[model samples]
Each structure stands twice: as structure tokens, then as C-alpha cells.
Target: MKTKERKQEDKINRDLAENIKQVKKVFQDCSDVIYREIQLSEHIQGLLVYIEGIIKVEDVQQHILRPLIEGLAQHPQADGEIYPLSFTRVSLSQAQSATDWPAVINGVLTANVAIFVEGMDEVLLFSVKGGSRRSVTEPQTEAVIRGPREGFTESLRINTALIRFKIKTEKLKLLDMVIGKVTKTDVALAYIEGLAEENLIADVKERLENIDIDGILESGYIEEWIEDNPSSPFPQMQYSERPDSVAAQLLEGRVAIFVDGTPFVLIAPVTLWQLLQASEDYYERFFISNMIRWIRFFFLFLALFLPSLYIAVTTFHQDMLPSTLILSIAASREAIPFPALVEAFIMEISFEALREAGIRLPKTVGQAVSILGALVIGQAAVQAGIVSAPMVIVVSLTGIASFTVPRFGLAVTVRMLRFPIMLLASAFGLFGIVIGAVWIVVHLTQLKSFGVPYMNGIAPYVPEDTKDIFSRVPMWKMKKRPSDASRANMQRIGKSRPLGSDSNEGW
Candidate 1:
């Protein structure tokens, strides 16, 4: 009975009297949905509907309400497009002639005012979207010293406009669609036409269109649905709040997915190496960027394998350490009651708990809490003989190493995989650690992101595309985009000698 009543209320009628009743009933108890009825002319009337916070009050009064009251409705036009009004632009919608009631509701909800005239069987959609959207701010998580500071905000149009401002090209195409049956959220798929592979674009579009969910609250939802390897610990899609980062990826022939109401945008056909890169890498000098790149690469391995290495060496291969170091480690562990594995698990879990608490708590207090917790907990655990000093040192180093990773998603993956590797090391010592490492490598080799290999240009190996992989090379030396991400438009620049400019200047 309730469902029937709701469906009936959604149906718009030609009779103005009946339509007003149905519209009011459908939006019952929703105070934000405002309705204003005005006598357009002596015998004609019009109903204006919009959400309270999403629209500009002055625009409605000046553009919409003024023209109707001034006698434009004296010769009311049946076609909304031809209807002369004070408004600069208007779109005509035939919602009364369709079953897509959700579209009509969504248009109004997103700041398009709906006008239903007394005699017309259609609604005029006016665009006067205005609200207190967040201004562009620097991305906190992906801060860069040399690159542009502006970042994507929760507003989808603003985010897209940021990208458009950077690219400034007709080749950049954005395909829009509405996802979520209940939420009816807007989603935009962006890519460069000639650069991005045709198959990649089609694959991304297909995956997005096939998603059958009640709502997509964030880009993560679409990412989980569309990922080629959902079970893999490695993130198949990259996320960034920086518009410059997105523009760079688009130029490399990868597609970007923009979801409404979130700052994070999803980039597809991402590789493990790409996730490790920072926007500043391209902004700074090649030598400095390469040094930072090498440091990140070293820390990545340290974060993943440092704890496991300590567990394996201390438990089964003490000979791997020097005589003095072995003696020192043994003395440090003398008061410890638990074995190496148990001590590691306890300290690692404690560190993880503190890290999470730091993130959840207030910013000023979070840092202090995490710092004090680590110092107090580590010292107390050692004093109580629950954990050894050496184990504490290992965990602290591993935790520090994890933070060095550029992407939080990859850092999380590393953190998760650390425990499993530690468990394997506890069971079979160094041999088990090796086995875990091998398994991880094999899994990465098989993984793909929207049909592009997750380990692209490495496991399969592309020589020409390796210039900016491990280290940043001089810009003049690099002339082609990554082959794996772009099958077409591989050439980036014309070939030239580094000193050709000097010679051409007649020096």
C-alpha cells in the first residue's frame, strides 16, 4: 500500500491542481524542498521548486520570478526553450512523459530549479546551482614543495574544471553518467582521445556501466567494483587529490574517474611504480629527484621485509650477524620472556594501534599521543620483560619506513603484508621469508588494473619506458610516454642532442 502511494505521488499530472498536490505529498516532511506558486498571468499560474541550500535565492527572484510576473506568461509558449525569460539559459524536460521520475528529482536536487506551468505538460529545468562548496586548498596528504599547491575538493564540477584548466586541450574528453539507484550520484570518466588506448577507455566505461549498486558513496566503491584483481593486496587503481597529478596521468594515456562528493579521484591502468612517484619528481632537478626516488625505493623494501628479516635472523640464523652484534642482541633479549615471534607480534600490534589512534584523534593531540605512546609503551614493555630492546628498535624502524612511502594505500598494503611475512618467518625462518617474498612477486606479476598489468614495464619489461621508472632522467633524454599505459601516441617529443641549442646559437 505504501509503495503504491509513493509511486503514484511520483507521477506528474497535466492538471496543475492535481500536480501540486502530488508534488507536495511526495516531498512531505522534507522542509528543505521549497515551493513558490506565482500567478504568471491573469489566467495562468506556475510552480517553482528547488532545494533550499543548493540554489541562489537572488537568481530565482531576478531571473525566473521577475520575467514570469512581468507578463512573459501573457503568451505562454508550449516549448520551454522558446519561452522568453530573464534567465540566460534553460533546458526543457519532458518528465511528465516518461517513467524516469528519478531524473526529474535528481535535476532539482543538484540545483536545477524545476518550473511546472499550469497548462504545459512539461517542466523547465533552470541552472542556478549555488552553495557553500569548499574552496580549492592544498592537499594535505600529497604535499609537494615545487609543484602547484591547489587540490581537488568534494565538488565534482570544481575538480573537473581544475583538470580542464591545466590540460586546455580539445582532445581531453569527459564522459558523464549517473550511478547509484538510490543516490543517483554523478560520475565522470576522463581521458585524452588520441593518447589513451581505445580498448582501455571502452573497458573502463563497461566496468563502470555494469556496476549494479544502490549507492556509490565514494570513488572507493567504484574502484572496488571495477578493479581487475579485487582480492590482491596491492591497489590496482591510484587515487590523488592533486589536479596536476591527474593531468600528468591523463597525458600518459591513463583514464581518470571523478566521483561526486569526494576529493579523491581514481586513476586506472596504474602500475606499482606509478604509485610510488610524487608530483614533485617532475618539478625538481633530475639529480635530486632521482636521489629521493632511490631513497623511497630502499625504504619500500625496508618497510616490507625489515621485521621479517629480524625474526628470521635472530631465531634461526644468528650467524648472519657479526659476533659483537649477536652478543649485544642476545644480552638485550636476556630479560625477555617470549620468543622472537611473540615479542614481534606484540610490539607490531601495539605500534599499529597507536598509529590508528593518532589518525582518529584531534590533529594537535594525535601526534603527541602517538609519540608519547611509542616512547612510554616501548620503555615499559622492555622494563617489564614483555618485549626486548632489539625488537622495539626493529619495529620502530619498520614503522618509520612505512611512512616514507608516498601513497597511503601502498603503505597500508605493506603494513598488512608485514604480519603475514612475519608469521612465515616464525614458522620456517629465513626460508619461509624467501617463500613469502616470491609469492608476493608472483601475485604482483599476475595482477592487472583494467587490463593493464599492475607490474607494467617491469615484470614484462619495456626498455624505452624505463627512463623515469627507477630514477628521473633528464627531460631532454626522455621523448616517449610509457608504452604499457599508452599503445597509441607513444612519441612525446622530437629527437635532439642535449647541446644542440648551443651549437644553433652560433657561439
Candidate 2:
């Protein structure tokens, strides 16, 4: 009985709380000193503790110092003391303890400094949590031709405010959690209370509570760690850098995880449709949006399979291509000694390399690389016969197709998964490509983002969730919540809009 109780106590001890000993214990063996100091004064006495860099210097000086300095000027006291402040009540997490580093780190993550009062062994935890965040600006990746121009900033508070500004619903609830032992990364789980399912909430919270990473730099860490099958190359979590995208997810009853220091917020559990979707689709006319959506969907396959199809057709399925086209390809590869696969690898890898180098290089050099890559390399390679003209065409088409994929993570995955499919097709022809595709589908079917099915809605065939999936149905027509999110309130818009429901007058 005693052993069981001790085990239970240990479990409780490790959980998040407003305790000093636990925090210090949590952050132990650190290079930085986790100091706990107390100074007395005639006016007031309190604790002053902080980690370097994490806290803003001016904020501590102006807000924390002015009052404390004035109090010390009036009230002179010894090092060992305790006193209360008469300033405005600051709303934040407060705790008392002096134990372990892990617990201390957790305390600091809660945006509190460890303070030990003179008389009391109990420590004081101040709520002065402020971190440096990037300024809000236009989203570079998700840039829109005609839509809301604002993008999400790195600040969690600002991101939440953006969502709040959009939905403006009391039902929108943000549940905050701190993950990682050393880093103590701030993670906020935002969802609509009525719309989100209780079970899913519990499941998400439970899964998060189980995380044991040392540091969490971005939402990707949480996404990678919490996924049901991390081994799968396909991304289970849907990530977006735009506020509108996150707002839309929240409206669909999906929970958004906001990690400090990253503009990207993760939404789960998502279907494949969510990853394929671009926020720009909804901002435009419905007809145009549907057409673009179809184009993107078609090109996504094109990007993934174009190169492989070229290799397979030239190697095995020669009859599939037109005789004229065959002659042109034959003319191109006639000078090249290497097979289709080798030629493809040389050009594709060069293109990918040039693409990566361009991003890393300065503006002048990058633009030069782009021009050289799109024009110089392909043309030069075809002229030199290092890669066939047909291979160059196939790689060029694939690159363009990849550019059209809206989701950055999924786009990267598409680029990554392409090479293997190319190799397979080179060996076994069309049969190899089919096998690779089957493998992807089977893996996707088994994958889960935070325990939510990856292929939900489309595969399971939930009709209610189809409104915003492939095509952006008219706003008025999307009357129900997306089903995969397992929201509690399935109905979104009823006979009335919640905003203007309260009428002014009968006249």
C-alpha cells in the first residue's frame, strides 16, 4: 500500500504545477544559475529571480523595478525578509517551493521567477511571462492575390488574438500547456468548447501530457512526437502559417496548437483534404476556387508521378507514347549513354540542388541561380545530352507541379517521396509505380495525427464533412461542422447567424 502511494505521489510530482522545488529540480544541472533571492525593505519585501535572455530587460526594469525601488527607498530592510506589494494585481501563475531543477524550469516556463521570502521556506512565483516575438507581416509562402493580407506572427498571444478577432465567440476556448523539460515550450490548444468533442479533447490533452522531449522549438516537434505513427514519411499533422487558415480550422472544430517562436500553428486531427486546401480558395469566387482546387489536385499527382511515368514509358511501356513523341525522345537520349533513370537523377538532383542553393544564397545570387536553373541547366543538359530532352521536360513539369501544392510540409513530402517512386518505376516500370502508390495509401490509412485518422472524411465517407474538403461550397451551404474533428456541436450555422441573431426592432 505504501509503495503504491509512493508511485502515485511520484507521478503527481512530475506533472505541471505552480511549485518552486519541482521547478528547480526540473532545471537542475543547468549552466545557468536558477537563483532564489529575497530582500527586505521598510515599504515592502519580495523575491527577484529570472533566467537570462528569457525575460525582457526593459519590462523587468520598468514594471518590476520602479515599484520595488520605491518601496526600498521608503522601507529599508535586511536580506532575509518577506513583504507584499500594493501595485495592481498581476494575473499569472504563482507557486512556492525550493526543490528540483525540472520543477524550477517548469515554473520559469509558466513565466514566473523563483522567489524565496526571508521567513518562509515557501518560494514566490511571479507572473511576468513575456518573450520576444516577430512582428506580424504578410505571409511569404501563403501570399494571396485577393484576400485578407494579414499573416500569423510568432507571438502566441497575438495569434490567439487574431483568432479571437475573427471568430469572436465565447465558445472559442484556449487550453494552454507546457511541454519539454529543459526548454519549457509554451503550447496553447485552441478550440471551440461547444464545437470540439470532449473525448478528442481528453485524448489530445492526455497525449500531450505524455510528451517527454527535452526542448520543443516549434509545433513540428509536438506534431512529430504526438503522431500515432511517426515512422511514416507522410505528415499526420496539418501546419499553416496564416491566421485565416487556423481560424478556418477552429471553425471546423479542429484544435490548433500554438508553439512559441514559430509562426506556424498545427491543426489536428486532419484529413488529407485539409492539407491540400489553401486559404486563398475561400476568399475568391466559388467557381474560380473550385477550378483552381481541381487544378491543384490534378497537378499534385502530376508532380508525384510525372518523372516516374516518363522513365517507365521509355523503359517498358513504349507503345503508350505517340510515335512522334517517341522519335523526339529518341533523338534527345540518342547522344546520352546513361539510361533514363541516371539522366533523370542528374537533372532532378541538379534542379533540387539549385533550388535549395538559391534559397540560401543572397538576393542577387539567388535570382541568378533561378534563371540559370530553369534556363541554363535544363537547356545545357539537354544540349550536352547529360540528361535527355524528355527527362528535362518531365523533371520541369514535376517541379512546377510540386510548386502548386499549398501545404509546405506536404509539398516537401511530395518532393521527398518522388525520388523513391522514380527509382521503383525505373526498375519495375509502371508496376513499380503502382506498388509505390499502394504503399503510400496503405501507410496513410494506418497513420494518425494525435490518434485521429489521417484519411478520415474522404475514406470513411463522411458526407457532412465534404462541404469544405475538395471544393469550397458556398458559405451559406456549409451549414455543419467538419466531422473528423469530432466536434460536440455538429451544426455550425443554423437558420440564423449567431452574430446578428439579436434583432434590434420589429420595424
Candidate 3:
């Protein structure tokens, strides 16, 4: 049997009264929506609908209501005017005829004013969006010493504009999409047309279309939904609050996902090495950036394996340390009651709790709590013979090392992996640590981001790309983009350096 077609299809009614009734019914319980009936003339009438806090009242008054009513009053009886609407008379940046009822409803909800004339079947949607939004300021998360201070704002349009501001080219395309069935949150997949892989962009679009969640309040929702390996501890995508960072990634043939109401924009096809590199790396000289990159890499390893290595060496391989160092460690632990593993766990857990407390509490007191809490707790634990002084120092150093990782997502992954590695170390000493590390490396090599290798240029060993991975080689030397993210037009810069500089003088 053929199913009956739905009677209530989204068709605009010709009669203004019917349109208003249907719109009111659709927005039945929505107190935020404002509906007003305007007298275009003595016999003619029009309906205006918009949300209260979102739409700009002045723009609606000047561009839509005033001009619309005044123009209609003068040309009440146009001889052959189609719909007798003066679309050009309005002062809006953009106006469109919304023939479908869903479009009109969406327009009103998304901070646009919808105007319906008495006889016209379509309503005019004016672009009068205005709302309370955070102004562009220095990004709190991705702060840099030398770079553009401006960051993305909560507004989706503003974020895209920021991107456009950085890359003023027609090739930088922003494909807009509305996800979140109930929320109808706006999302944009931004990429350079000639640089970003077409297949990669299509894959991102497919994954986003597949999401059927009720709402998406932040970009993290999309990140989790579309990530290549959800179960893996490593982040398959990277997020940055700084617009310059987004611009840099876009220039690298990567795609950026801009979610409405979030300053943090997500970048696809990220690697373990990319997370360790910082924005300041590009701003500083090559040698300085390379040194800092190495420092970050070293600390990243320390954050993940330092405590476990300490436990494994002290408990199973004491002879590995010098005589004086071993004796000093033994003296510190002489009064401690718990074993090395137990002591490590106790200190690690306490430190994590303090870190979380600091973040969750009020900013004014949070720093104090985390710092004072750690110092007081560490001293008390050492004096009380609960944990050794060396153990306390090891945990403290490990906590400090985690902060050196530039990307928060990678930092979190490293922090989570610490526990399992520590357990393995306690169980089988250095062998267990090596086994766990190998397992992680295997998982990362297998993971894919939109079909691109998650650890691209590293596990696959693209030697040409090593300059940017382990070290920030000079900008002039980085003439090509990453192989995985870009299929064509890989050349980013030419061999042009200052004439007097060593990079160009010999050539």
C-alpha cells in the first residue's frame, strides 16, 4: 500500500493571516519569538516575525519595517509590479525570498526578520542578525608571544570573517551546513580549493551529514562524532582558538571545521608531532623554534613515561643508577611505608585531583588552590613518611612536563596514558613500559583521519617533511605542504630568502 503523503508540508500561504497563524502555531511555546502586524496601507497589511534578543531592532525598523511600509504606501497600486514589493527599497546587506515555511521559520529563529506581504506567497528574509557576542581578543588557550592577537569569536559569521581576513583569496571556500536537528546549529567546513584534497573534504561532509544528534552546543560534539578512532587515546583532530593558527593549518592543505558559538575551531588530519609544535615556533627564528620544539618533544616523553620509568628503575633496576644517586634515593624512601608503585599512584592521583580542582574552582582562587595544595600536600606527605621526597619530586616534575605540550587534546591523551604505562612498569619493569609504548605506536600508525594517516610524515617516514615535524625549519626551507593532506599544488613558498642570509647567499 502507498503511504499517505504528509498533509502539513512546509508551503507558504498566500494570505498573510494564514501565514501568521501557521507561524504562530509553529512557534507556539517559544516566548522569545516576536510577531507583529504592520499596516502597509489602509487596505493592505504585512506580518513581521523575529526573535527578541537575536535580531537587530534598529536594522529591522530602518531597513525592513520603515522602508517596507513607506514604499508600499507610495506604490499601493502598481499597474504591473510583480507582487508590488520594493525589494531594492530595503537597506539590508542581503535579502532573499523564502518560499518554504521551514526557511521562514529558520530565518526568524536565526536572528533574521521575516516580512510577509498580504498577497505574496513568499516572505522576505532580511539579514539583520545582531546579538551579544564576545569580541575578538587574544586567544586564551593558544596564546603566542609574537603573532596576530585577534582570535575567533562565538559568532559563526565572525569566525569565518576572521579566516577570510587572514586569507584574502577566492580559493578559501567556506561551505555552510546546518547540523543538530533540534538546535539547527550552523557549521562550516573551510578549506582552500586548490590545496585541500577534494576527497578529504567530501569525507568530512559525509561524516557531518551522518550526525543525527538532537543538539550540538560546542565543536567537541562534532569532533567526537567524526573522529577516525574514537577509542584511541590520541586525538585524530586538532582544535585552536587562534585565527592565525587556523590560517596556518589551512595553508598546509588541511580543513578547518568552524562551529557556531565556539571560538575553538577544529583542524583535521593532525599528527602527534603537530600537537607539540606551537604558533610561536613560526614567529621565532628557525634555530630558536627548533630548540623549543625539541624541548617540547622531550618534555612530552617525560610527562608520559617519567614516573613509570622512575618506578621501574628504582624497584627492578637499582644498579642502573650511580651509587651516590641510588644511596640518596634509598635514604629518602627509608622512612616511607608504601612500595614504589603504591607511592607513585598516591602522588599521581593527588596531583590530578589538585589540577582538576584548580580548573573547576574560581580562577582567582583556583591557581592558589592548585599551587598551595600541591606544596602543602607534598611537604606533609614527605614528613609523614607516607611518600618519599624523591617520589614527590618525580610526580611534581611529571605534572610540570605535561604543561609543556602545546595542544590540550594531546596533553589529555598523554595524561590518560600515564596510568596504564605506570601499571605496566610496576608489573614487568622496563619491558612492560617498552611493550606499552610499542602498542601505542602501532595504534597511532594504523589510525586514519579522513583516510589520511593520523601520524603522517612520522611513522610512514616522509623524510622531506621531517623539518617541520621534529624541528621548525626556516620558512623558506618549507616550500611544500604535507603530502597526505595535499594531493596537488603542494608548493607553499618559493626559494626566496634575504640576499645576505646564509639560506640564499650561496645559491
Candidate 4:
């Protein structure tokens, strides 16, 4: 059987007998496909159709059954009439085509009724779907030091509502589609109606409609599928657990996607600099923000190339070091048999293994395992001369560097790429390090996040955007919107001296 089954090809003047007959054959053996045939007030005969798990029976009983069924008792004259009812009076456009199969599935999934009648050609839909969901709670990742602690939930509707609560403007438009034939996942495309560029909106919608994946378990699947370059290590879309971040992006005219079953929402048309920014940067004082930004930048480089630099510097460029420093390094390496490359790889890979194991194991045991394993192994290796004490120091610093990256997903990519760069540095010394950095930079320059260049505000030189890239300038001085993703309406808030502004102050 196909994943999606349609009950009706198109509207037909209903012969209740004929319609019910067709619906049953298509829904064969589906016990949850409930069909409750009853006269509305026993006056109008119609059938209520809905799948079981997707709806609340109590809502059906209270709103639908109690209203119509109880009303029937009050008006004995209307009993079993089957021709007319006041509830039918609510819609003058009752005869209009209800919706397509996808919409029907959407309504059913959301606890709606597809009411079928004897004479009406189109179905009447009523939304009543309800189920218990966890109330919006603080984000585990991307925790805030200030502002609303609530984050996106697994429910896509709830997530949209969270965004709507923050930005109540009518310009906040939600465009939706179904992806993943098997999962039939709900994907929402949200952007400000006026602020979002027409071309960018159209491009995003086009890409989504064209996707034909078997299942979209989370937003990452959609992000990966729609990205411009599949082989690129960098993320084109930024994922966030915070709704305010998404709201901020939407206000700036970037599109946000919320996938069902995942709390993390994906913000498209992002930049490399955007990934480096932590929400905390906005909350903190500017001086602290700038300091933190530079610190993160320093570590980001260290994370990417520290081990390789250590290996290359020690093994291939010993002459590059001063006499005293060279002797100290030579004394440490005097007993070890392995070259810098092998020594670095052994310690780095071991640290990585411990880090990964800590995450996968239970919270109680995972931390213990990682800590004990690292301490014990590093001590033993140094004592046995399998690796030098300095080698342990280098590996530890590299691990710390990876943690300093702001975005977790980007940090992961950094970790995965670290090895390859280390390999090259080992093979060709300092020359390989420069070649690797150049290759990464070249690849980044070509990558696009949605239609916006990923490397923009850094490369191709937009000087104004630079203030917000490596460091967060005072809010008043950041008078313009980021020009990277935005082409129209670049100046968001007016520029003024940050010196005297109440909201703008020293870190």
C-alpha cells in the first residue's frame, strides 16, 4: 500500500451510501478509521470521520456530539429531519471544495473532522484535535542568561505559536508543506511577509516543494537536503533551540523552518559569522562581548589547527624555534620513538574517543568514564614514553579549543575536519597548513546559505557588517541590519552615539 491514501479524488454530490462504500474499501482493516453515523439532533444524517490516535474523543463528545445530540432533544420537531440545521447556517460557502488530500491529512493529524453529508458535495471541516504536550520549557542547549527561557517544543504548531507570541505582526507568514512520504512530516516555512525578499521566499518554497525524501525525522534532514553543496563541511543553515533567535532572524527577513518532532528550528540564509555569534553576545555588555568574541575566535583557530601546528612546528620546523626553546622541546622528545604526527594523532584520537564515549554513556557513568580514562591513559602514556607530557598538553588544549566554538553543529564539523588538517600538516609541514587553510577558505567563499553567500560580511568586503562579525559593537553603533542576508531595508534601527544611550553601556 502507498504511504498516503486518498479517500476522495474530487468533490461529488454525495450519495451517503456510495461515499461510505468507497471510503471503507480504501480504509480496509484500519480499525482506527472511525465512522460514527448519527443524525445531527437526529435531524440531519451525516458521518463524522477521523483517525483515532490523531484526535481527542472528549473534544468530539463535548463540542460536536453534546452540542448537536443535546440540541436534538430540545427540538423534537427537528429530530431525524436530515434536510437542514442551524449549525449548517454558519457557513454560506459550505458547498466550496473543502481541501485536498494533503490538507485532509493535515487536519486529521491536528484533530479535525471531515464531516460527510447526504446532499452536500463538499466536506465540512472542524478543528478539534487535542493532546497533552509538555509545556514550553527552557532549552537544554542555548540556555539564556536573560530573557524568555522557553524554547521550541516537538510540536510544530506549538513552535509556530511560540514565534507568533514573540512577533505578533500579521507580516509573520507561515507557509507549510508535507515532506517525507513515510513520515508525512509537517514542515513550516516562516518569514516576515513584508521584510522577506520575494526572490528568497520563492526560492525557499521552490526547494521545499521539490524535496522528495522518504522521511524527515528532524530539521537537519531538510537542511542537509536543501543545502547548495552536499560535500561542504560547513552548515548553510543555523539551528537554534531559542524562538527569540528565530524571531530576530525573521524580523531581519530570513526564513525559519520548524520540523515536526524536533525542538530545534532551522534558520536559513545564514552566514559563517552568524554561527560564531552566541545569543549571550547580545545579552552581555559590549566590551565583554567583544572580549568573548575574540576569545572564541582564538579558540576556533586553535580547535581547527592547534594539533597540526604543534606537530608541524615540532617535527618539521625545529630550526624555527629559539635555541633555549628548541633544547627544552628536544629534551621532552628525546625518549619518545614516534614522530610528532603519530604522537599527536594517538593522543588526539584518544581524547576524541573519550569525549564521544562520555556523551553516549549514561550521565552517571559517562562523565566518570571520560575523566578516569583520560587521566589514567595520559599518565600511563607519559610514564611509558608512548607520548610526551607536552604531547598530552597539546591534545588537551585542542579539545578545549573545540569546546570554545559557539555553535555545536559547527563545532562537530570542526572536530571531524581537524584530523584531515592534522594529516596534511604531518605530510608536508608548515606548507601543508597554509594549503589546507586556503582550501577551506576557498570552499567557504563559494558556499551559499540559501541564496546569500556564506562568507559574506567577511569576504567580498562589506565594511559596515564587519563591526558585528568578529565582535559585537555597542547596540546603538550597530544601527543597521546585517547586510549579509538582507538586501532590502538594510537600516533597521537608526544610528546614534552609543555613549549616552540607556540600553548601551560599558561591559
Model-by-model lDDT, in order?
0.86, 0.74, 0.87, 0.80
User: Could you tell me the C-alpha RMSD of candidate 1 in Å?
Assistant: 4.1
TM-score against native, each model: 0.92, 0.81, 0.95, 0.87
Candidate 3 weakest ten by summed lDDT = 1-10
Candidate 1 structure quality by residue, lDDT tens digits, 85-133: 3232322322222323555676787788877777555666777777778
Segments in model 4 whose C-alpha atoms lie over 4 Å from true places: 1-21, 37-46, 71-110, 117-122, 322-325, 495-507
TM-score order of candidates, best first? 3, 1, 4, 2
Best by TM-score: 3
Model 4: weakest 10-residue lDDT segment is 88-97
Q: Distance (Å) between predicted and true CA of 359, model 1? A: 0.4
Roughly what TM-score does model 1 have, to 2 decimal places? 0.92
Model 2: residues with Cα > 4 Å off, grouped in runs: 1-47, 51-53, 56-62, 72-125, 450-452, 496-507
For model 4, residues 178-227, the per-residue Cα lDDT tens digits are 89878889899999876778888899899899998798998888888788
**lDDT comparing candidate 4 with the true structure:** 0.80
Clash pairs for candidate 1? none
Put down candidate 3 lDDT per residue, 1-507, tens digits, no spaces. Answer: 222233245667778888888888999999988888888766678888889989778888877778766754235345632443543477777777788877888888888888888777777888788977888888888878888899888999999999888899999999999999899999999999999888888999999999999999999999999998888878889999898899999998999999999998999888777877899999998889988888888999899999999999998999999999999999999988889999999999999999999999999999999999999999999989999999998999999999999999889889999999999999999999999999988888898877878778877889778878887666777778888778777888876775656746332
Alpha-carbon RMSD, each predicted model: 4.1, 6.8, 2.2, 4.3
Number of the candidate with higher TM-score, 3 or 4? 3
Candidate 1 ranges beyond 4 A from true positions = 1-12, 76-103, 496-507
